[model samples]
Target: MKPLVMRIVFWSVLVAALAILAGVVYEQYGRYRAARDFPAPGKMVDIGGGRRIQLDCRGAGSPTVVFEDGLSIDGSLSWAAVQPAVAQRTRACSYSRAGLMWSDASNAPRSAKQVAQDLREALMRAGERGPFVLVGQSLGGLYATTFTRYFGSEVAGLVLVDPSHPDQVARVAAFMTETRSLRSRIAVSLAWTGLLRAAAPSLLPQAPNQTEHDAQAVRAFAPKSMVTQMAEGDATDAVLAEAGAFRDLGSRPLVVLTAMAPYTGSELRGMQITPEQGVQVQAIWEKMHEEMAAWSSRSAHRLLPKAGHDIQFDDPRAVVEAVLSVVEAVRAEGGTPPG
Candidate 1:
């Protein structure tokens, strides 16, 4: 009976639908444009089964240093500050896991063991020879250890940068493996809708030292990052437990770096961590890194009080020193890295 009102409602719904469709189209176009602007910086090696991994290597030397990135971050981007320095001393490689930027997604689960195999395969196929020095940070630490466990002969040394302990699930049950937050969920939704890429700032305030190209690439590929990060959250508990299965590194020289800074208000906000809980978590984290240092008889536990969790970004010197130190130890052990 209310034809006029019904017509208005119908038109409103049509207009809204049209607007959303237009935004979606625009977002796709933007992603294509960004990819063109910042293409893959390294070689995309096929790891069989129609899937490929991005492996970017630099410098020239032996005992190749391979970097494993922390949760959700682009592998190479995380090492922007540290890798170049390490590369100057020896060969350095950074790679993206499946579903991450430039790497083809896989149907396989994102477990530590799986990631290790994927890496080994990629390196082997790409002819990136080993007697490799593995450097891992945060979640990457687990994958690095697992890789060594499965392929010990090739791994000559290890440098763990604020690495996550395998037992962290029990130590900090509240937030150890739970990475999904209210903010992340919101970001994921926005990313899929293309709103995130659209709303991204012209400059990345997070990493001021980054180049303009890097900043633009971050904004463009952020949507893919959000989804991959969420998938990784699902595998955290499994990777932790799996990596914990190996405890001893025998005589392999190990260096465990721990950042002593407590969680800031901003960081705590992102993790939804309370101030009191942050203190407890911090204490537990330090102890975990200490225990990891004992994995090798020749291990050193270096504590950087001024640095935060992302020590590479905050203190590139510390990371560079640790990695180069491990490389020196490996050379002292008399292992020649095959190229």
Candidate 2:
């Protein structure tokens, strides 16, 4: 009886191990196929140190409009809903940051300053000249702020879509009994082991097209992608601290879009925050967004009534219009490219 029981236990363990190995192999094969079938639609430019970043540019005219992605999101896909429309009006470009999507992974520190510098190098190498109208969403907003601070002359306009404020982490953490940092750590760990990839849906329901679906799959499971994201998350405080030292935009053309809808009680509960705490979160987010708008004397602050944090996905038309307004403002001020 004991021998029979031991045999059963050993067989069960062997089956489970084989299943996990099969899942890992399947996911790896899927990643390889996705990369081959849906190659980058734009040029891969060497930023420096033999590392390459993907940059996709469309249309023509300048000051060029550059789109930057939110944290961990694909730079090119995040702007899908708005970029094509903006490109019709002016030269528009979106790029993958180091270690995201089609870009090569980097060992550099993942702070806003470092990211902004990388972008500057990529733009120069790609010959995407600017007096750029820089558009950023979420954490990309921090990079935009840093870029404007260091390369103010190169940026002709700025549009921030439901932007993340430098003080967001500390302020929001103060209100929550538990933060999402631990969850993020676990998720990244699972990604590294390919467990998340094995479980994640092959196609994102929210993905509007095949290109975006492939991009989402790559981002969802890539260990290097998660490492870059974790690095940025860990450096948020330091990035925000440095952001505080930069001077305001003064009279730069700026537009700040603020999302007003708070998470529902159930949604807050799912995140382990009480409904009351969720209210506080929304209030603080709005307050911080208002402060961001105040950075530029010429800025316009628009409250998006029903939009969530990813306003580009929720209400892309709003983002498109905001960017066009900035482009028109720059062109009106004779910030066009030289003939």
Q: Top model by lDDT, which number?
A: 1
Estimate, for each residue in 162-248, the C-alpha lDDT of model 2 and write its tens digit.
Answer: 887877777888776434567667866766346656545542345433255655545553554666777776777787888777748
TM-score versus the correct structure, for each prediction: 0.93, 0.87
Computed on alpha carbons, the lDDT of every model, listed in order, comes to 0.83, 0.79
Please list all clashing residue pairs in model 2, or write none if there are none. none
TM-score of 2: 0.87
Show model 2 residue runs off by greater than 4 Å.
1-20, 181-184, 202-224, 265-267, 336-339
Instruction: List, residue by residue over 1-339, the lDDT tens digit for candidate 1.
Output: 699999999999999888888888888988798678878877999999999998999998899999998885465777888889899999999988887777888898678888999999999998999899999999898788899898888998899999989888777776544555677578677675677777667323556356666666767777776578787887788888888999878788789999888778888886678888888888888898889998888899999988898888888899899999999989986964221
Question: Which prediction has the highest TM-score against the true structure?
Answer: 1
How high is the lDDT of residue 130 in model 2? 78
- Tell me how far the alpha carbon of residue 120 in candidate 1 is from the true structure, in angstroms, after superposition: 1.2
